[model samples]
Target chain A: MYKIKVHVYLKENILDPQGKAVTNALHQLGFNEVQTVRVGKYFQLFTDNVDDIESRIKSMCQKLLVNEVIEDVDFTIENAA
Target chain B: MYKIKVHVYLKENILDPQGKAVTNALHQLGFNEVQTVRVGKYFQLFTDNVDDIESRIKSMCQKLLVNEVIEDVDFTIENAA
Candidate 1:
């Protein structure tokens, strides 16, 4: 078995209204000084052991996980068995 | 300043075409036995010190970071100053 961790986010140049909204919400909730915020996603998966997980993961990001138009994705594979 | 890592991925049970495409690409590249693959994204940001990064981060995930339609997001804040 293998454990994979995938992380996702918007491209830096892109405007993250979602991120900004959250940052504003935070200010409202009490935490100030938060200049900005960026948000993304994550996943943990168990897979049958495979070699070359990194490249494959990256390929996956490019092909499906990310919008490429606005978002980006990166993944790490760990705890292979 | 605070550093945040945001990860994003498709929600479990949601079909991950990107992940599948990547896994297939991996097999083409030589690594086999890879039954499953999932992909996501990551974002790192340096922010002016904020009082509560975790909850705020999580709130961001719920409100904006994730699609809620097909994806999910989680964030970790570290190296705060």
Candidate 2:
């Protein structure tokens, strides 16, 4: 099997309310160090197919894993078993 | 400023319904290669404090950013203007 790690995040132009909320909370806690925060999704996929795995995962991302119009995804695959 | 990237995921023994659902959907879509899927959260924290940033972020993760009982968090810090 292969272990795939994927990171998905909003495009640079999009507004992320959850991130803003977290940032504000940090500031309220007197953590003046915080400048900004952005929240997103991470996914791990276990697969049996090993051949051309990167392309396969990319295809999966395109079809169901991400909204290409608003989010960008990056992934890495590792051999598990 | 510094950019802190965090990855938060469920503990090994925890059940991930969202991951399972995605796996089932992929199989139904004829992608039998997929064996399992796990979903998690990712965060990017922009901070102004660069000195001893790692410990500070780890403290944040332990306090409000994660449920220590159910999830594990890992983070990296980068220098960003």
Question: For residues A18-78, what per-residue lDDT tens digits would candidate 2 score against the true structure?
Answer: 9999988887876778888999999988877777777778888888999999999888778
**C-alpha RMSD over true interface residues, model 1:** 4.3
Off by over 4 Å in 2: none
The candidates score, on chain A by TM-score, as follows 0.82, 0.88
Q: What's the lDDT for residue B29 in model 1? A: 61
lDDT, candidate 2, B1-81, per-residue tens: 778889999987999999999999888877788888999999999877777777888888887789999999888888777
Best by lDDT: 2
Q: What's the distance in Å from true for residue B18, model 2? A: 0.8
